[model samples]
Target: MCGIVGYIGKREIKRQLIEGLRELEYRGYDSAGIAVMQNGKIQSFKAVGKLSNLDEKTKNFETEGPGVGIGHTRWATHGKPTELNAHPHMGEYSYVVHNGIIENYREIKAMLEADGVTFLSQTDTEVIVHLFEKEIERHSDLFSAFKATIDQLDGAYAVLLITQKAPDTIFFARKGSPMIIGRNRQGEVFFASSDAPLIGEAEEVAYMEDGTIGYATPDLIHSEPDALQFVSLSGDKLTAQKGGYRFFMEKEIYEQYQVMGDTMIGRVLDDDIVFEELGKTFLEGISRIKLCACGTSYHAALTSSYLFERQAKMPVNVEIASEFRYKEPLLTSDTLFIVISQSGETADTLEALKMAKKAGLKTLAICNVDNSSIVRLADATILTRAGIEKGVASTKAFATQVMVLWMLSIFFAKKRATLDNHTVKEELRFMSYVPKVLQKALDVHEKCKRLSKRYLHGHGFFFIGRDIFFPLALEGALKLKEISYLHAEGYPAGEMKHGPIALADAELFTIALMPKTLLYEKTKSNVEELSARDSTILSISPEMFELADDFILTHPHKHPMLEFFEMMVVEQLLAMEISIRLGNDVDMPRNLAKSVTVE
Candidate 1:
């Protein structure tokens, strides 16, 4: 994913665009550039590597008068990360910055090349400007040319274009990617990939819906009235501050205690689970649930499947959203299609939700973003309330998703009379103490930090667990691999002997999750089998294992879910500490973006 920012205002353009790009640094980028309309001409600056480099390049460049500009921080997709391949690609007439893939760019590039248009950069985004230049030759109107160019494109894009023909106007469009338009009291307009950059800068904001083509000027934004739903931004503040922590990952790991509470605040009341977003008859005809997601959200879906099947006695199927559409899945009327995404703009998951809707199935979205694409498409949505997750490797979002799903499982069980009144009340009471349990889990930070030092040089890692812990292990391995750049695999404990045990050796590190409440002894035997092969074992449980090379003791709890939450904290902290000790970028890991807006 890449980040795009544009401004049409009276303020100085360079500094404002640079600051907006800085706020979007978490989206991950290797090169950045900006193009501004100054003195009736487009002036551009380009830099390779980090927003700081772009800031340095633009420091001495001065511009005056009311200006309009578009800036981009690019994550390499079509070409290598070089200054030539950076955004703000210029044609003979227009300068453009874009996010998301243009699937048919190769065909378009070929046509432009045959027409004698010279290409300056090896980027799909370069095609946009060239195409616009061609269209403007056909139609004198700037907006008409922009619209014509967009009509010929295929695949996801959030594009911003500025032309000398209209020096005070910025033209933009959204397909599968996200774009937001905001304005201050002074009639200055702002555009960004997310609300993070515009939170305090704009007094009101509106999300640019998919298939929207609009233009903005300093005085007003031009779009169909029904297409733009603006919201006042008086009380909403950006929550991305790291506070006292070294990184957003670490701060988010610690914020789990508070965010978990935030997720459950209105939903849990008087030993009853209430989801007001889901109407009274929301579950009336739902017999089975098909959970679809990708990456970290998929792992969360897997974790919740256990609760939904065991606690609610509901049949569930989990599908990787990227693969769900290709296989032509069978959709039933009684099946409730549930999709999970942190940003709610994940391309595959959103596509899967659309497929489910077309098949006439009830749809629900579990997401962190309020007005995201998936949220709007689904029949109902449950917000994760994790605030803004700045880290590319997710921590708090997973915790809140599992918390919400766990409560939903109990709510279903109570409604179906599968669990009696007393058991439901007890489950709710135990949930009330989860915030404190999460806090106690944070106490193991120093132990995890010390253990990370010993783990830096391992050949690889195997995160192993049983039943519900299997999904937790998958999440643990993903976190480690995402930030540490280490090779890691997650496997069910019993399945290790089938083939994976051959890789276990003294150089291999096995992080074993052995909860006391369920399958502990069986999982312990599996750990011992790996230890016999000389694998370095790091066991996490309420009780110590004598065979473990290292141990992190969790407090014993009456329920397995409590131990699950506690071990989750341990897994997250261990991954963050190891990545930190390796001197890696824990927040913005290499080749990863906070949101996956492109497939």
Candidate 2:
């Protein structure tokens, strides 16, 4: 997930572009660059690393003439995170900053090379500017060349172009990634990847839908009327402040108790769950579900698979979005396709959603972003009220996704009469306790922090559980591996004997999830087997296991879902603490960005 900021305004070009890039740096910070029109020429400055580096490079530089420029904070995809591979990539006549991958860039680069074009950098984005230069030679008109170049590309992108031929305007196009255009009463136009950078800068904003190509000048903004989705930014502010926490991940882990309430606020009625967003005819004739997602969203989907089947009596199939399209699986009208993503701009999940729509299957999206590509493309959407999840590992988003999906299962059960009204009401009552359960879960934070030291040195981590807890175990392993740079795996407790148990030893640390409400004895017996193998067991449960080397006791809950929430907090805090103790970036992990906008 790279950040894009472009301005055609009355403000100082260098300061405005750099400040905007600073606001959007959380999207990416591997490298940063800016390009502005100065003295009838395209002036560019680039630096590797954070926005601070770019700011330092441009400290003595100033811009003259009309205020028009484009800037980028890159999360490298096609090339290494070096100055040569940073954004604001230039061709003979155009400079471009791009987010998302161009799948067919190699073919187009080959074609451009054969036509005597020299490339300066090894980036998929460099092909865009070169292609634009080639198309400008053929079309002559700037907008025509922009669309012509866009038409030739074969993958996801949100591109901002500044050309010497048309220095007064900033031409842009969005295919799969996110881009927003904003303007104020002073006739200043702003473009950013999200509303974060444009919040205080512009009075109103419009999200550019997929397949949209347009341009923004100081005095005017133009796009196809039907493609512009405008919203007034009267009081919208970036709410991703860390407050008093050391990192956004820490703050987000503690936010679950509050935001989870936001997810269920209006939906949880006295005795029924309602999704007002899903109109009367939304779930009609749905016979089965195919859930597609990647990474932690995949684990959330896997967790929901159990809920949909056990509670709603609905058959479910969960697939990793990256692998879903390659399998050539059957897609049918009776099967409702659901995709989950925290950013909603995940490349694989978005592509999977498109493929399902192409096959004519009714699609639903569970996402946090309001109008992301997947949310815009899906037939229906359940927006997770997790707000903005700034952490790359995702703590609140996963909890909210599973929370919403759990509610969806109950809603389905009530609608289909799969569960009696009393049972449905009981489920609703349990759902209401989630916020409190999450608060109690946070009580284990100190314990998790204290235990983090013991987990620092280990051969590898094994997070094991059974049934629904199995998915939670997988999520725990993912969190540990994500920020701590540790090798970890999650497995069904019973499957440990089959292949995984061979590595069990004193150095192997096992994090066992044993919720008393569901299959606790079976999972405990499995943990005991690992303990017998001389594995150091870290038991997370309401009851203390005597065979464990360490124990992080959780509050016992009436419902298994409540225990799941409790264990989730334990897992998240433990991972964060371990990462912190190891001197790793808690919020922004290496080799990873907050959003996976490219494959």
Candidate 3:
């Protein structure tokens, strides 16, 4: 849930770490810190609040650092996100930084305290440096000290260690969290939580497998896996972060076109779609389908349920993984469970998948992260090719997952005879039109900015829709409330009178997720009802709903089957715009981390 950067090269390390921290801010953090071993000492600096605080603190200092270093932007699972808890924890001689939970830290701390290792902070991370110092006395070498310290660390972690004794080397290790190493032809080696730091300097990378350790030296990256064999290495990009965009979200939004292009690269056919990985027998044996996910992934599931129900004629249950696990769902032996997670390591979703496996159900995981625990455990997995999404609020990953589910539904429908081969082919043909449509959506930036400023203060926003589009309404309101600091609610179009009509007064801003579909009549009537109550109407439809006398906006038009993707993009954009208009941090929202790794 945090971002880490470490370097042991002949270049300045603070700039590399600060640049990487910008990408990692979406993971969530209240503070940032960095430690550099230069001039025979470990120099450390930390600041409370965004990475900017740390940047300001170090701007006047000599940043011409050519030494070993480590930096961190925190997510605060162990303690409050304060300068004291921010990483790059230092001891008498060693400095260390880490990500993921150190579950056995207290026991280790008591043991160290008995040895006269004084405590400085209330963080589980601090113990790693103290332990490293203790181990250094026994081993005397940096690599041996790292090995001893890690052997005693019995929880999830991605650690980077350095000291004055080894000013030209950086020792790193990982068990559960992600870490990667990049090396250049000149022998410059660097390490990071991801390959975000070596964008322009070293695009060559070898993503470290779980339980792997890396020692970064000026000349080479020495990688050792705790388990077995060597892995393939490749130089991906000169800069692996966001290309040249100001924000990861903007770059990711634009990459939707590339992501979708790659996803649809070769599977299209004249009359049907085929998944190269899923064997025909897998579909042949399945009956009903269950889609499990959480948050944005869950919203994608709801959209996919419609595709399966209509195009495939399959009874699909789109259930929230947290709620679904408790229900102990009525599953058949032939039921095919499809779980979606961007990280492929969602805690509740992974647990729910385990229960499905125990019930003897065939399972398929749709994930972005390749070969993750969820992917390894599933019977099979459909890998969505969207790359790393650093923003706390997901963008490209959500769009790509929805596209995969839609394509899967189309393929399943053709096999099940719910839709003719010609119909499925036509749907795939229409999907090629998404990129241009999304570009048009991005053009309305000024309009969204104005909307957020004008209606930013609505006491409660009510979004209305009918049928499956109702979930889009709920999801839009959810995103808005999450980052925009607005109280919002979504209701089925026909359910306005059941209980929500009482709050549909002039003070409320209501948005209708209506498209030119069968439920248009029901959605139109809801707009009329809101108009009668004098509520501010913001209708989201391909064509404006005339009944609502409020400002009108028409999202990019798509075939009824593809309209929800367009709708989702609109809401996501609006939520982000509104968050910024209100002066709230868009990337790092309050009380939220991009990934909920811990309970």
Query: Which 10-residue span in candidate 1 carries the lowest summed lDDT?
Result: 235-244
Which tens-of-lDDT digit does each residue in 1-599 have in candidate 2? 47899998656899999988887755435688999995458889999877778888999888755668999987654555789999899987679999776767889999999999998898888989999888877885789988989999876788999988876899999876778898888888899987778878888888888888888777667785355767787543445235447888998898788678767755776688977668788779898999999999999999999999998888999999989979998998999999999988999999999999999999999988655789789988887767667888999999999999999999888888899989988999999899999987888888888889998987899999898899999999999999999999999999999989999999999999999999988998899899999999999999999999999999988999999999999999999999999999988899998888887
Candidate 1 colliding pairs, count: 0
- Per-residue lDDT of model 1, residues 1-599, tens digit only: 47899998778889889989988876556789999897578889999887889988988986777889999988665556789999999988689998776767879999999999999888888999999999998997888888999999986789999988888899999986778999988888999987777868898888888888988887767774246788875533245235447887898898788678767755676668877677778999988999999999999999999999998899999999999989989999999999999999999999999999999999999988755799889998887767668889999899999998899899889888889888999999889889899999999999999989999996899999999899999999999999999999999999999999999899999999999999999999999999999999999999999999999999999988899999999999999999999999999999998889998
Clashes of 3: 4
Q: What is the TM-score of each candidate against the true structure?
A: 0.62, 0.63, 0.61
Q: What's the lDDT for all of these models?
A: 0.88, 0.86, 0.76
- The TM-score of predicted model 2 comes to 0.63
- Ranked by TM-score from best down, the candidates are 2, 1, 3
Best of the candidates, lDDT: 1
- Model 1 ranges with Cα > 4 A deviation: 1-240
Listed per model in order, the count of residue pairs whose N, CA or C atoms clash below 3 Å is: 0, 0, 4
Residue lDDT tens for model 3, 326-402: 98578898789989998878988999899999999999998876546788789988867666676677887888888
Q: Rank by lDDT, highest first.
A: 1, 2, 3
Every model: Cα RMSD to truth: 16.7, 16.0, 15.8
Worst 10 residues of 3 by lDDT: 227-236
